[model samples]
Target: RPIFWVGNERTTDHIHSILTESEPWFEFDTSRLEYINRIKFWRYLLGNESFDADYWLTRVENDFE
Candidate 1:
């Protein structure tokens, strides 16, 4: 499974610490995990357009799948 760490810097750093501590117990490859800032993730999803609830929902669903 792929793990997406999406949050601000502080939260992401906290997540990173947790992941590092638990890496030895993880069954899957840790390399597959990714750390993406929330702002960048939103930018990637929204592109140059304004916010659309349906579009955001659909994009998140499709991308996760």
Candidate 2:
């Protein structure tokens, strides 16, 4: 098996949806610092004013393409 860096959260989430909806041949690294930073970066870009995890979780997911 080969490891692929999916780049950002949206792609990761989209890939995750596909994986869970079917038989997945790939895995993701959603826990890495880079992934975390991408999420935060998006939040920053989107004017994330709420510090609540719940808000951030939804906000990040919504920012996904």
Candidate 3:
């Protein structure tokens, strides 16, 4: 059978796990889709560290509280 994310908790966990898989195929289409669909808000609020923690953290310290 197949697994599916039911609600928000299961959904978010599934997403994080999928990113960790880190397959090449996952990186382009799948990852981009994930970013656009689920992660876009983070990029908007956090910008790219949305994905990059190093850049993001420094940016936060410099730009935000």
* Runs of candidate 3 exceeding 4 Å displacement: 1-35, 49-65
Worst 10 residues of 1 by lDDT: 31-40
lDDT of 2 by residue, 1-55 (tens): 1257645543334522322232244235434334445556655876964423324
Model 2 — which ten-residue stretch has the worst lDDT? 15-24
lDDT (Cα, tens digit) per residue for candidate 3, span 12-48? 4454444334446675667555544444455566576
On TM-score, the leading prediction is 2
Error of 2 at 2 (Å): 18
Task: Give the TM-score of each candidate.
Answer: 0.19, 0.30, 0.22
- lDDT of all predictions, in order shown? 0.39, 0.44, 0.47
Cα lDDT tens digits, model 1, 7-50, are 55333344334323434454544422322233235547669334
Clashes in each model (backbone N, CA, C under 3 Å)? 0, 0, 0
- In candidate 3, how many Å is residue 17 off? 5.5
Candidate 2 lDDT at 23 equals: 26
Q: How high a TM-score does candidate 1 get?
A: 0.19
For lDDT, the strongest prediction is: 3
Distance from true location, Cα of 19 in model 2, Å: 15
